[model samples]
Target: MSAPPPADSPRLDLLRFLERVQLQDLQRTRDWIAAEEKHAVLEAARRPAPPPPEWLIEYGIGTGRPAARVHAGSCWDTRRR
Candidate 1:
């Protein structure tokens, strides 16, 4: 078996390397979020607002003839079954 690394050896270098890799990954994630936000803003600005429905202006409540009502004890009632 090999002897353990000294205090000032490459053993501590692994920590530094890991830190650098993590920092690079964090920067990449931040850049991706910024790009996605910019894309969303551009897409929202390019989209047009939908026109209002025509029925809203012409149709009124109680303007048509009353509809026939079904009997309460009809076969359509599942609760009784």
Candidate 2:
């Protein structure tokens, strides 16, 4: 096997420079990600909620059973399975 390069070698210096450049790029990417997340949160807050469904189907107590009752969306007496 060949001996390793010295600590002060030009190749090592170039690698260190590349590492610093990549680190700066990584930090910039993280900043961009944070900004995008903040923008998405703000957009979601500004957006209005969707309207409730016009119809509701109440299922039976057991699995694979047919719907027990079909009521209007505004019905308040709906029971949980």
Q: Which candidate tops TM-score?
A: 2
Which residue pairs clash within candidate 2? none
State model 2's lDDT. Answer: 0.90
**Residue 62 lDDT in model 2?**
73
lDDT (tens digit, per residue) of candidate 1 on 2-59: 8867777786789778999999999999999999999999999999987643322223
| Candidate 1 residue pairs in backbone clash | none
**lDDT of each prediction vs. the true structure?**
0.66, 0.90
User: In model 1, which regions exceed 4 Å deviation?
Assistant: 1-7, 53-81
Report the C-alpha lDDT of model 2 over 1-81, residue by residue, as the tens digit. Answer: 989999999999999999999999999999999999999999999999988778789888777978888888788866564
Candidate number of the best lDDT: 2
